[model samples]
Target chain A: MTALAERPYGGSRGGPQGGSQGGSQGGRRSRGALALMLPALVPVLVFSVGPLLYGILLAFTDARSGRNTETSFVGLENFAELLSDGDFWESFRIGLVWGLSVTVLQFLASLGLALLLNQDLRLRGVARVLAVVPWAMPPVVIGLMWRLVYHPDAGLLNGLFGTRVDWLHDFSLALPAVIVVGVWTGMPQTTVVLLAGLQNVPKELYEAVSVDGAGAWRRFWNVTLPQLRPVIVAITSLDFVWNINQFSLVYVLTQGGPGGRTRLPMLFAYEEAFRYGFFGYAATLGVAITIVVLAVLGLYLWRQAREAD
Target chain B: MTRALKHLALLGYVVFLAFPLLWLLSTALKTPQEMAALDPTWIPRRPTLANFADAFGEQDLLGAALRSLVVAVATALITVTLALPAAYALARHRSAAGRIAIGWVLVSQVFPVVLVIIPLFMVLRRLELVNTLAGLTVVHVTFVMPFALWMLRGYVRAVPRELEEAAAVDGAGRLRALAAVVAPLLAPGVVATLLFGFISSWNEFLFALVILKDPEVETLPLTLVRFVGPEGVARLGPLAAASLLATVPSLVFFAIIQRRLRSGLMAGAVKG
Candidate 1:
């Protein structure tokens, strides 16, 4: 279904409307198209693209968050200071760990749930609705709901286990605890996408494999995994990007507490710019992290594309 | 035995997915004393409407909600209005610029928000739009624009060119054909995009946190976060109640999209 949905619209237009166009006629039509595009283009240029370019430039200047502060170009100074900034390094490492682990775990769990929901099972209707319910939730609310679960004394986790662990404040436990919530929060969309992919898999291939005396495991291993590869690559990379830049969820959950154990890159950048007022340095951090994330994503996608061939 | 095991596994997944929500519902209903209990029951012993009442009365939740509603509605309407024609152009009239527009949408999604928000703050401050709902609304509209355009483009592509061509043959101009033939066909997609924009703006926190630093101008998500005080148990019920209230719009959105997904108009929207 997703594969069909993703098919581009360029090839299918072959009619009186698509052809029989004169050169001058095509030029006039394109002019009209450009005029139609202008209203949306203006705001996107002024607000989105302009800010992004200016932000990269701001990384090299001494732009503090106050007026009367003279801004000057300080090329490599912020980067130099960032090199020795142990807190920034810690947060970067934590961000990678959080992003990678949560994404991997979320993919695995969602795959299992998606496969289960794809089955001809009872209560499928009820379970399917419950599965995607989290996608409807606000991130802040998901964080708060998990916070309630992970609370020390009166929380549900403690009550369920009859234990008294302060999950969010315990230095060693905080990251893992928050990672659980991350996995849970991201499962719904991942599951939905995977389920869509699963539904698109050819049933006849499974039947053929079954006739060859292949068991359930063999059929799934031979058919499902390869068929779902494109979707897996797309979703995991997207999930990684979303998880690493995540702010509001962890902000509400732990606020990067327990001595910055769960301080993802965005939270670290947020604290730097908003909490401590280091606009230039924070912009540098933001630019640096983006470069790293893109590099990682590029490498991953390149490998996946190679594998797909 | 294998069938039983599969059922058990499915049940386990359901419980894992639903338990936290049930816990939230239970917590929202419990009294302060029940909340403070060392052994919190899965079901509240004496459920009350007190927490909902308290949450409503405690903060300026209504004002924040109104602000959030205004921002979301404006963002949705403006985003769809701008996106519709652009989407039509991209779909029906392909150009190099259209390809570039799609590239921008994908690039915008991958880039970190920090990189954009810092310079945007400076821009807003220069215009003296900081701490204003209009500023936040502008930011929300732009933030949701790329995806809105992308999604609407898919919807536009779904409406066959033949319909518009037939309308053109009937002596209608391009704009008339669009209004008369394509717009009605694109209604479901437009609504989906609008609700998508509305929900995105409504649930937004990081931008609102930065832009609306003045508490008087805080949105619902910001105000909801404030319900989390240092004091723990006493504030739990009201926080739970308020959190639930904050989620109503999104739930309504999900309900609409769920129905659309069943009918097949929302597959591209979900992918976006």
Candidate 2:
């Protein structure tokens, strides 16, 4: 009985020791991975997540500029005010129009351009390089350049037609002017993505369509469009997000102006916070805009996921 | 008939793309009289470099350009440095968490910089970093890092792990194998990421406008804005000249990187 109990106890102890060692090794590996990840994660958490959370918190408080002491818990007063403000609603309308027009125009133009460039044509390389220039330009510079071109006197547009018309100063034309610049600046990446998609399409398929006596239009509609559906969806979704968030072009060109003609949601938020000193209201706008963007993005992502299966 | 129509359409598009740039160059070279002339001419009569000189003289354009360069280059370098290791981990480490991390980086790009500007401004103000080059660089790196990580992650994943493993078996550590066996192969991707980050940072305006309020710390775009204040009459010739000068660095940078932006590099590298 003594020998049997001693042997069993010794064996159990040995087994536990081995298991503990293995557990320690696993723990060390996980710890090592966490250590490697912490440096990258810390800044993102502190700067990215921290500020976003603070902005959300500030939206609920009566935060103001200058004194910084006026911040008190105002509850949903900011949201109610933003909801009632005609200027905020106008800005939202402008943003919606701006986003829709820019996305549609840019996507179509870029898709066409990409398709054109994908062909085995002379000067394809040169055209591709030229296409990227507008996108590479600073939005402020683009704004200023277009503003110059749209100037009533001594501007390129008026000069070309020999008819002076105020582009920015006119309420009707200001939003359209901003949209044109948006399309120009956003075309390059969409073009590149579509071009990549086009290249992925097999040559044999095109040849097969040709053998079936399909013309260029028929081939493009049947073969190319289906092949490029994924890319089209991706680029359109990205363009929407970008257009919705755009601030620099509108800021520099119109400053939400010509009697508040081109005020985007972001521009309105900026003016409220910085120009008008309504931090809480501005934060509400920010939150609203964020929700809108996420909804749009979420829809696209869900569709993509569904299609992926 | 179809071919003719296609050619006409292509020509029209090309003209649309090229006209604004051509007009800018023309305005820059035109004499003040020519620029202000009622009759618009495609080419400047009595073209002169006086506008260019005036643009340089009227503002610290050169100094601003230099500052922009420093900020862009520093941001690119710093972003690439921080992103490289993280990208490697994301690409090579096959796990659920790694996938989530990669997705987060992509999602972060969608956040408008304007939303975070208030907090960033507050932080920078408290740190006494506003209006400083370092402040701008930090803001730039924060903005550029997500995209750099996304792009570089794709590139790094393209590199074959077997090559690194083979090197590891020959008595090299993981870091050493990464440095010697994998990095050289990733040169194109590295260049692409660096160029993309640099250009994006260089062109950034909103943060620069709010943060760099001091005239001494102003960038090219801000300086150009100063040329067209509400009170002052717009100097069409000088402003056009200045705008042209501002575009030069980006144009040059894009030209340099255009050749390296082929599609199959990532797909080919990963598959091989």
Classified by CAPRI criteria, candidate 1 counts as: medium
All models, RMSD in angstroms: 2.4, 9.2
- Per-residue lDDT of candidate 2, residues B91-116 (tens digit): 65534566566666656656666567
Tens digits of per-residue lDDT for model 1 on A150-169?
88876999888888899999
Clash pairs detected, candidate 1: none
For candidate 1, write residues B82-164 as lDDT tens digits: 77877777777766776677667778777788888888888898899999999998889878888787777777777777788
Query: Each candidate: fraction of true contacts kept?
Result: 0.50, 0.26
lDDT of 2 at B80: 88
DockQ of each: 0.53, 0.28
Candidate 1 whole-model C-alpha lDDT, 0 to 1: 0.84
Per-residue error (Å), model 1, residue A69: 1.7
What's the TM-score of each model vs. the native? Answer: 0.95, 0.89
Error of 1 at B88 (Å): 1.6
